[model samples]
Target: MSKQHEKLRMMLTAALFAAIIGIMAQVTIPLPLVPITGQTLAVGLAATILGSRYGALSAIIYMLLGAVGIPVFSGMSAGMGVIFGPTGGYIVSFIFSAFITGLYIEKTSATVTQAFIANAIGMLINLTFGTVWLKVMADLSWAEAFVGGFTPFIIGGILKAFLAAWIGILARKRLQSARLLPSSTKLSA
Candidate 1:
């Protein structure tokens, strides 16, 4: 593909990923601090598929859209206030999680095991950011923050990570078979 075409493809991919994240945010299970949303899966998939820069860009786009009052966030809420709310940390975490996960997948190449590792690490980063943000935002103790936010989502997060990793592996296989992705050596470099 020509340079222009490649750029267009990347932009399209980023938009698609952003849309997926936005849609996933709408699918939520209510909880105390932050609700459970399918966004983690979307983030993992974006990272696995698009690599670091594009994955991060996609997340940035999602945040920007939500911040601009698109109601793309969980509970269909938006604005800078949301970013500073209890769930704000989780939102911020998406950027790092996608970037790190994508970097891991891109460097190691996507395999079931590698995807699992990447997703796990990425989720950890998310939790870290989220928990800290929640504590500060809500003025809660560590235990309270854990109970209100992190603890409730552990099992779900694991399951989602596994699911995302599995899907990522399958997608990678399909892309490779279809010659959509570059070879491993080229991707690694």
Candidate 2:
């Protein structure tokens, strides 16, 4: 494909992944402090498939949409209020999580194992930021934060990581085969 065409494709794909993250954010299981949502999984998938640059772009687009009151956040919540709310840390961390996850994949390969490790690390990053933010934003003790933010999500995070890894790697391979994605060199571009 032409260079211009490839760039367009990447931009469109990033937008699409942003939409996917918004949609997935609706898959929420309510909790006292931070609800478990599919947002992290979507972030992982974006990273694994789109690589660092586009993956981070997808997260940035998602955040911008939510900040602008697009109702794209979990529970259909939107606005800068959500961005500054107790759960805001997770939202902000999505950009970093996607970038790091994609960076790991780009540095190695998009195999399931590598993706799983990368996603797991991303999950930790999400939980850490979220827990700390929850503690401060919610005025909770460290134990409370650990219980409400960290402990409850560990198993679920692992499952989501594995799922993201498996599904992301599979989808990425198909996208590459269909010529919907650029070559490895272009992935980091």
lDDT scores in order: 0.84, 0.92
Give lDDT tens digits, candidate 1, residues 1-189: 565665576677788899999999989988756789998889888887777787888999999999999998998889999998888999889999999988888788578888888999999899888998999999999999988888888888888889888997788678767766544512321
Best by TM-score: 2
Query: What lDDT, from 0 to 1, does candidate 2 have?
Result: 0.92
TM-score of the candidate numbered 2?
0.97
**Which run of 10 residues does model 2 get worst, by summed lDDT?**
180-189
lDDT for position 147 in model 2: 95
The lowest-lDDT stretch of 10 consecutive residues in candidate 1 is: 180-189
* Most lDDT-accurate candidate: 2
Q: In angstroms, how far off is 180's CA in candidate 2?
A: 0.2
